[model samples]
Target: MLWGCFSSAGTGKLVRIEGKMDGAKYREIIEENLMQSAKDLRLGRRFIFQQDNDPKHTARATKEWFGLKNVNVLKWPSQSPDLNPIENLWQDLKIAVHRRSPSNLTELHLFCQEEWTNLSISRCAKLVETYPKRLAAFNGKPGDLIVINRLAYHHWAIYIGENEVVHLDPEGGDSSSSLELLSFRGEVKRQKLTDLVANDSYQVKNLLDQRYRARDHYVIVKEASSMVGRQLSYNDDTYNSQHFARDLRYGEAESRQVRRAACPAWAGLAAARAATNDFSDRRLLYRSLKRLSK
Candidate 1:
């Protein structure tokens, strides 16, 4: 879900959250979502001004529908100042979500929006002074900086609040990195080790994904067991039935020999990098930054 920022501080209060959403909806759909979130703010009778850069749809299919007389579409900076506080606010809000599970998705969305309203503007201003940290991160190891960040538990936060920017999102949503798992899993060291294991669950996941790819290339077929062979089946058809592929017969006895070697989490990370076929140092850095920008 996406939400818009509106500030009553005249023209200065702007909502600056950056996130990615999929698919395209009609302009009315976009406006309706924003309107609903606006209502969620409980702003009462105050006239909170809202502005946005020209979204593609504004000039396309739903242009007329969205050209409301009161709505203002402001011009945007090619590269805006790091002084904007909402940037840091977004980081902290994400951190909260990454650290704890909300009651549900509705609660999660409301919590983030509430955090934004409650964030201290003064703290976000302080982060503006640290803008050099970002420039330096880019200048010194523009390449390595992203790698260090990407490999972090999730990702680092640059928290923006009423005044200070709290760095957030140290890791990510998947097994490769789990900020939530690390925060609540167990002792830091033991949890780190457990997270590093990439358990049977993870292996089977990879196998299933690989099976689909193979099928696309005509390397596999669709029978219960045709996933890896022309005719195959397993006692547990539940997982296979859902994925429409054969389950890993770990009992195949061949799986037991799987180089079951593992080291400390940090060392394991290094080994993972070396053993992984797709972990290109530069390519990964490029991809990581691109992902953040989006």
Candidate 2:
């Protein structure tokens, strides 16, 4: 097997593994070849390391090495080969090598080196650039909840798939608009997937199934869409995007009792209470504990 790393600027060193590679062996190769390549390419501390979830790659020793070196490893999902650019590079290399019609192992190795060298920097950069789009596509399933934390506040949106999301916007006008027509703080609007996630870090909450009993996704989406352009008071406690999401999923009324300051955290707690059919404020703490214990 062959192991390599590349960046938008250029390809890194390619190391050929002749036999079985354990965690230690893999670490050695990374330390020797990969680290040297990074240094040679002047990557400095700006690059993020990407690796699959192979046992050897995720071994405790390997993780400790990264921590000691202060290396930032990209969090990758398991069994997601489509998101790994290196996999595509390997396929391209294989195709290039086969075209050479190498007759022996030495010739095959030579062909691989030549093919790896021939991979253009622009092509490598293009592959790297696809990372975001791949990630967006992976999480762009219908009815998926996308949450963005903007330090002092949090925002919520429902992914409609097809690179679009339907979200309640406080500043949205009373009309339907495309994703491109809406801003982060705009009124309830449908916007492209990219606009929602521009530069902020987001998470696929996927909490619908957990918070409420499974329902037809189409039904949930339809309900979410019906709320588009519908005006609701924007109170952090009673009516906000989180409340909007809960109402769409659970069909429950927002809690009006203002026992504390309104915030997304409080909204979430209220939603959790509603999920368990516990809407009363009487002995709230005990009731919540009992429901949780059950």
lDDT of each: 0.32, 0.66
- Report the Cα lDDT for candidate 2: 0.66
- Tens digit of per-residue lDDT, candidate 2, span 97-194: 99999999899888998899899988888878877776665554567677766533567777765556787766553323332211123257777655
Q: Which ten residues in a row have the lowest lDDT in candidate 2?
A: 175-184
TM-score of each: 0.29, 0.47
Which segments of candidate 2 are over 4 A away from where they belong? 78-82, 140-294
Per-residue accuracy of model 1 over 191-222 as CA lDDT, tens digit each: 11112221111111223233232222112211
Best by TM-score: 2
